[model samples]
Every structure is written in structure tokens, then in C-alpha cells.
Target: MNRLFDKSIVLACCIAAALGLAVDARLVAAFCLGVVVASLAEIAQGERARRASEAASYAYIMVAVFAPSFAPFAPLALYDIARRVRREHVWGALGAGAIFVCALVAYAHAGALPARALLLTAILSVAATLLSLRTAQLEREQERMRRTRDELQERALVLEARNRDLADRQDYEVELATLAERARIAREIHDNVGHQLTRASLQAEALRVVHADEPGVAADFTDVKRTVDEALQLVRASVHALNDNATDLSVQLERIVEDARSDGGPQIELEVLAEHAPANIANCFAAILREALSNTMRHTRAQNVIVRCMEHPSFYQLVVSDDGTGAAKTNSRGIAEGMGLGSMRERVEALGGTFTAGPRAGAPGWRVFATVPKQQGDDAR
Candidate 1:
């Protein structure tokens, strides 16, 4: 923009120089010459506004450039130049000539020397003013263009930042899930294969003691066979869980609750605010509720549990409350607890949703609220 304005201002001054040095009629003709360039520029732009306006602009510019000696018309001509043409050759020529004509008239009447001096001073003053206005306009336009470019650049930066933030958050979620799955795998190894191997080792030692002499290997073989069989069952169960994520959220929650009960972990009373929900949302709610209840059993002493799963067309809400005790009494999300409900909160939040857990209002228990985005829930489903 600055370059464009500079070039235009220089062009204006060059045209003005030709006019000041020329004879009067020729000065007018030279100032009017830019009509050809303006018309061609308008044609190249294919801008109807410029093309439609060519005639009026040309007339105004020509008048502004040549009307000085034709004065009282000069100022009107300048105004018309700005209004009709917006810009043209007249500002320098006519403006300079007006002053030159007056100064020359006065010097000659008063009998001052050679007409040359008056013409030089008057022409210089007009030339200086025209170039001055041109430069000022250029500066203002440059600043405006700079501001617009900066604004567009700022918007692009903001979008890129948001995109990066979303991608980082997604990567973090995938990492967390892998870690959780690995931990479950470790637990499986401990519970199934580890125990079986230990039992087999013990039985082998017993067989070693009992049959110090004959076919002792038979007993050890029997124990090894039994342990391997049990290990196979455990492996199959883990595979089933991995493949069957299509189960409804409520069913998963019930399974978790029943498992906790069987383990004699904790007694929890669960309630559903909706009998059936959109199957998609129903899953995360189920997970969130299950995790909340798991934390209640593992971490809290409060007994009574009430889980409300609310459904709507566009969104869903879950409130898992446990009378086990308050947050003030125990931490649901401390590093000491490692990967439990805190991890659950992180999981829910990653789905572009909200998860809040704290002490229940007016109740001495912890309340867990998890709301997953409907859009993400649909994808999950």
C-alpha cells in the first residue's frame, strides 16, 4: 500500500512539473493527459464503479489542473476534484497557476523586474502544497492498510493456536487410555497367570516331597496342566472385554457394581433418572458412573449411593453421589490415589465435555458430575 501511494504521489508531481514549465494551454493539456492512464487502469480493474465514473472524474481532474487563472473557479474546481474524480492532475497545476498569475500581475503592475521571479516563487509554492497533500494521504493510507493486514494475521494465529491445543489434548487422552489398559493388563497377569504359576510351583514341590522315588513327574505334570488351563480362561475373558464395548452404559455400571459387591468391596445403592437414554451418551455416562462408584468403594467410607443419569435430546448429565464421606474427609483426585476417579475426570474432559467432583452440597458425601458432549458421544456410539 505504501509503495502504491508513493508511486502515485511521484506520478502526480511529475505531471505537475510538466504543467508549471509549459505555456498556459499546453499546461492544461499536459495536466489532462492522465485521463488516458486513469481510463486504462479502470479498464484493467474491470471495476464498474470506476468505469461508470470515468467521465465525471476526467472532467473534474482537468478542471482542477487548469482553472487557476480561471479562478474564483479554482477552489470549486479542487473541491470537485475530490468529490467527482477523488484525485487527478489539477491540484498541482491550477493551484500553482492561481498564485503565479496573481503574483505576476502584481509585480508587473508595480513595475518589478522580469516576470520570471514571480512565476518561479508561485509555481514552487503550489508544487510544494500538492506534493505535501499527496504524501500525507499516502501515510494515512499506509497506516490503515498495515492495521488491516495485522488484524488478519492475528486471526490466523489464534486459529492455529486453538488447533494445536485441541491436538495436544487429544494426544494426551490416547496416551492416558493406553496407560490404563496396560495397568489392567498388569492386574490380569497378577490375578490369573501369576497365581496359577505360584500354585503349580507349590504343587510341584509337594509332589517332589511325596514321590521321592517313583513316577513323581506325573503329579507335577498334572499341576502344570491345571495352571495353564486356568491361564487360558483368564486370557479369553480379557479378549471378550476388549471386543464388547457396545454394551449399554447402564449394563456396564451394573456389572461393575455387582463385581464390587462380589468382592465385598462396598455396598452401593444406584438409581437411574432415565430408564433408557440415547445409546451413545449412555456409554460414557455408564463409564463415568462406574468410575465414580469405584472410587466411592475404594476411597470413601460413606455408604449410601445414588446415581442419577439424566438424558436430553442434545445433551446428557450424570450425578453420582455417595454418602460415604465428603471431599473434606478424603481426596478423590490426589496423586497418592494414582489412576482412579482423577483419571476418570481426565477421560471425560478429553471428550470435549465437563466433569466435576466435589463434596455434595449440604450433604456429607462426594458428588461426581460428568457431562459429555453429544457430538463426541455420537462418535463414540
Candidate 2:
């Protein structure tokens, strides 16, 4: 658009110059011919054969010098040539200088204008060329700055994404370390303190047996034995609690799903939304899920399985479902007591949770659902 406006100004100047002199049909035709050829050359400046366009533009300027009325329009072609020249193109510089000198000579020989008019035209043409060169330089600088800005923005976005991933990795590492420490603590208690308590209980039992003939002594020893046994039970319970708490439900479920996938099992999707589930609740759900998946893989020709564990305000729920025709057949035949379904039911009922397993009512699949009241699960633990 800027180039077009500049060309328009040059054309207007040419018209003004022609008006100052006598206008004739020949001069008008020459002016029109020069304008059409210059416009075509400008339009083709970026084509593969742009050298041809440049040659044509230079040729038109040389021809215009003989038709003095069209001489003023020569600057349009010179401006394009000046803008296109690069520092590396030494031949291009020589060609442009030679064309300018030739045009000046042609004008001088024509003898159609006074020397003063000719000199003014020469000065204007030089000024126009220099302006074109400066404008082209500014455009190149602007394009370079734009590319640099885009590259920097792309790099900044990449760095920001990496920072977010790093932050998430750090958080996962911290959780894993905490789980490891808890497991270590549980092992220490079971190996050291729990063993010691068990030994004390055994020694008290032996003493009670040794003093069985003396009722009073036996009674005291028996009481001591009972106390030691109670202490041992407490220690075992604490160890079990620690071990349960050390388990991350989501991680365990993910490992199970990944293992199943690797073993050529059906596609399995597991989602655990119980972020802060209690140890006993988590343990119950994990055990049930393992058994449920085992049964599905063994008894059903399932193509897709979905396992979801969710925590509600008053209860925690787990659902394992699979899409398979075999499930409905199994349901119709009646699930045998020998199957793992009995064990799943026992685990859920022990925690005061409801358990149900059957073919879906309207869907073509099997669903095993269990829900334990939050209060009962915590109390059971």
C-alpha cells in the first residue's frame, strides 16, 4: 500500500510536469505506456523471474528519457531499482548507475527542455531513490523485530509449561517419600517392639503355667500374662494401622490397571476420588477392587472395565463394572459361594458397608457396588 501511494505521487508529479509543457496525443500515449509497463514490473517484482521485471523497469526508464513528457515518470522505475539493490549485488549497483547516467544523457541530447528544468528533474529523481532505499531498510528492520518477538514468546510458553511439570513432579516425589517413611516406621515397630512384646507375653504364660498349683500365685501370673497379651495386641494393631496408612490407594489402583493392561487384559479405567480416605476404608476398597478385577478377568470375557472409588459426606463408595456378555450368563447361573464374591462381601460387611453384585438392570454389563458409612469405617479402624 505504501509503495502504491508513493507511485501515485510520482505519477501526479509526472502529470504536473507534462501540464507545464504542451500536452499532445503523442505525449499522452507515451505517458500511458510508461505507467502500464512500470505497474506490471512492480506487480511482478517478487516473482521467480524478478530479474526480468527489473530489466524491463530499467529499459522503460531509458525509453522515457527520449520522450521528455514521460521523463518525469522515470523516477518511479528508479525508486524500485534503488529499493531492490542489496550491498552484495555489486553488478546491480553498476547497472543502476549506468541507467541513471544514460537517462541524463538522453535528456540532454533531446534538447526539448532548458538546462534548469533538466537539473531540477535530476535532483528530484535522486531524492526519490534515496527515500525508497531508506523505506526498504526500515521495513527490513521491522520484519526482523517481529520475528524476534514471536520466537521469544514461543520460548517463554515452553519454559512456563516445563516449570509446571517440574512443580507437579516435586509434589509426587514428596508424597512417595512420606509413604516410604511410614512403611519404614511400621517395619521397625513390627520387627523390634512387636517381637519384644510377644516374647514378654510368652514368658508370662510360662510363669503362669509353672505356678498353676498355687492358686494365688497362678492368679497373679495369669493377670500379668493377660496384661502382656493385651499390650501385644495393641502393638500389632498399631503396626497394622501404620502399614495401611502407608498405602496410597490411587497409586495401588494405577499399578493394578497398568499390570492388567500389560498382561493383555481388557481396557481398564480406574478413578479414585477419595483423597483423604481413612486407613481401614482405603484398605477395604483396595482389597475389594483387587478381588473384583481378578474375578472379572477370570470369569468374564470383558472388553472394558471401569472402577470408581468416591468419598461422599457420610459414606465412601466403590463400583467396579465390566462390559461382557459372560457376566449376565454367570449371574443367571447363580454366583457360587466358592467364588471370591463371598470374601468381598465379608470385607465390606465387616466395616458395616453394603455390598451388591449383579448384572446391570438395563445395561449390558456387570456391576459390583459397595458403600461403607464414614462413621462406621472410622470406628472399625
Candidate 3:
């Protein structure tokens, strides 16, 4: 709506005015001359914007200045009047008013040529100033929108960061509980299944020794031996299943690492120091490994990784490190501080243990050392 009443629109109406005024070809010539001159001024300014307004404003001003006393077209006069509503263009109307006044005064007793010149010049200057004000307002609105867009983008980034942090913390808690449960299951299997199998094997051996002394009991001894063999097979299969399940912890750790790495792929090295570690200790260490690996991949620029498992009398310790820049070198979350030191401590303490994760004392990378106690459940007593 605003654009429709711009200086260019006024200029078009002025052309019709010039035609209707029965003004000589010279006046039409004057309108075209003003257009070319204003366009060159706009070009010389090197702004490229508001060309239509510039041309029209100058043309309209010329007609307005010359029209009142010289019989300007009614439509062109109305166009200029409409432009006064534009806040910046109010001044253009003022200038046109001044010129129109002067023209009326001068033409009353002055030569036609001088009267036309003074009236048009005043009107032209007024139009140009008003158009410039409109252009300024539009630019201000555009700048305001741009600022709003930038601020929204910044806020979105902050929200995304907080969301990611919460997700990582939730994952850490879930993995800790999983490790504890696996340890409990392991204890149940070893204390019950393994003990019963050892007792059956011992009984079968004793029966065989008796069979050697009594031929009549030889068949009974053979059956006892066969039963022992079947029991042994079942025990072996159970152990194998436990071993298969053991690998699941490692797989889960790798998945966490992958999430941390996101775009980059993480390479993990897992080491087990105690092959017969208590289920609780082993599973806890596996969870720690996963968390450390995730931090390294997500935050560090380094690539290579090493996980070391150390055995103790009543506890197991795992130290996960990477060849990357380590925690101290970078301020942003590096391997040692990726999930945050507080979360790491919680994981170890949750299992009645202690954990320390940080740069390896002056070493090139970071390390996480978690020590969890060994406990027996239903069968230990």
C-alpha cells in the first residue's frame, strides 16, 4: 500500500498531467529531463535502491511546482496530495507548498519562465528529502528483523546443548544399574550352578572306586559315571553362555562411544585384567569403559584409545585413556570431563566404589580409574 503512493507513482501521474495541461512539448521535455537527472544522481550515489521513488519524486515536484498557476492535471495534483500521508513525505508536501506559493506570487507579476523555474525547484527538493526518509524507515525495519533472527538462532543452540547434556546423564545412570544387575546374575550362577556340578563330579569319582571292589555294583557305577558326564556337559554349556553374555558389556560400551563421537567414528581397546573377576566388578568396569570411551570420542581431537584393567584383592579397577588432547589441554569437555567429573564419581559411588577421571598426570591423554568392591549375594554365606 505504501509503495503504491511512492514518488514513482506520483511521477507517472505527473506525466499524464503534463499531457493534459496542453503544455508545450517543452514541459513534457522538462519532465523527462528531470527523470534522467534524478536517475543519474541515484546512480552516482551508488545505492541502486529507490530509483523509482527518486525519478518520480523529482518529476512530481516539477509538475507540482509548475502546475497550480499553469493548469497542472487534476490527477497529478491528487497524486502529490496522497503522498503527503507518508510520514517522511510530509516534508515533500511542505516544499511543494512553498513552491506553489512562490509560483502563485511570482506568476502574478513575473515572466512565465522564471515563475515556472522557481516553483518546480522547491517542489523537487521537497520530494527527494521525503523519499529518502521512507527509504530510511524501511532499512530500519529490515535490520530489526535480521537482529531478531540472529538472537533466535543463538537461543536454539543453547537449548540444544542443555538437552544433550541431560541425555548423557540419563544414559550414565542406566548403564550403571545394568552393570550391577549383571554382577548379581553372575554371582547366582557361580555360587549355585558351579558348586552343584563340582559336588556331582566328586560323587561319581567315589562310586567308581567302590565298583572296583564289588563286581555286582559295576553297572550301578557305570550309570553314575554317565550321569556325571551329562552334568559336566550342562556345566560347560552354562559357562559358555556366561562367556557369551560377558561380551554384551563390551558391545554396550562401544555403542555409547559411537554416540559421543557422532560424526567421527571411535576406535576402542578393551582390556580385562582378571578373567575371573566378580560379576559386579567386571560389569561395573565395563560401564566405566563405555562412559570414558564416549567422552573421549565426543570431546577430544585425538584418535587412538587404550583401556587397562587392573586387579586388586577385593576390588577391580579400570583405567580408560585416549591418545587425544586429554582433559587438561582443552576447556570444552574432553575425554576425562566429557560426561562431567561429577557424573563419573556418581557411577563409581553408586556401586560402593571410587572413581577418578582426568588427564594422566602430565601424559598426553586422559584416564578414568574406577574401583568397585567385590560382593557375594545368596550363596556366599
Q: What are the RMSDs of all candidates, in order? A: 17.9, 8.2, 12.4
Better of 1 and 3 by TM-score: 3
Candidate 2 colliding pairs = none
Model 3 C-alpha lDDT per residue in residues 162-250, reported as the tens digit of each score: 98988976775676567556656766776787788678777767887877778668667778778877876786667645544553444
Prediction 3 TM-score vs. true: 0.43
Which tens-of-lDDT digit does each residue in 1-381 have in candidate 2? 667777787677666555555668777776777677668756774556578767766776767655676666677777777777877875775676676667676667776755655665676677768877877888899899999999999999999999998996687678778888998999999999988988888888888889889999989988988888898889888888888778877766665666667467788988889867877777788788888787777777888999998989999999999987763557542563356778888999999999998888898877999999999988875
On TM-score, who's better, 2 or 3? Answer: 2
> Candidate 3: where are CA atoms >4 Å away?
1-8, 16-22, 33-143, 146-184, 215-222, 248-381
Q: Could you tell me which 10 consecutive residues in candidate 1 have the lowest summed lDDT?
A: 71-80
Q: Which residue segments of model 2 deviate by more than 4 Å?
A: 1-5, 8-16, 25-46, 87-89, 114-117, 211-234, 244-381
Model 1 ranges off by over 4 Å:
1-246, 262-267, 273-283, 326-328, 331-333, 336-338
Model 1 TM-score on a 0 to 1 scale: 0.32
Q: Kindly list the per-residue Cα lDDT of model 1 for residues 1-381, writing each as its tens digit.
A: 433443355445444433434357734553444444333433444566555454443454444434333221222223223322335655654554454456446655674423453354345435544544665676678889999999999999999999998896677456546645755775776677767666766666667666756665766666666666576566655544443333345555555565566444555666555544545455567667667776777677765777677666666678888777545456444542466666767767766678877777896778888887677765663
For candidate 3, what is the lDDT?
0.58
Ranking of candidates on TM-score, top first: 2, 3, 1
- Candidate 1: Cα lDDT at 160: 95
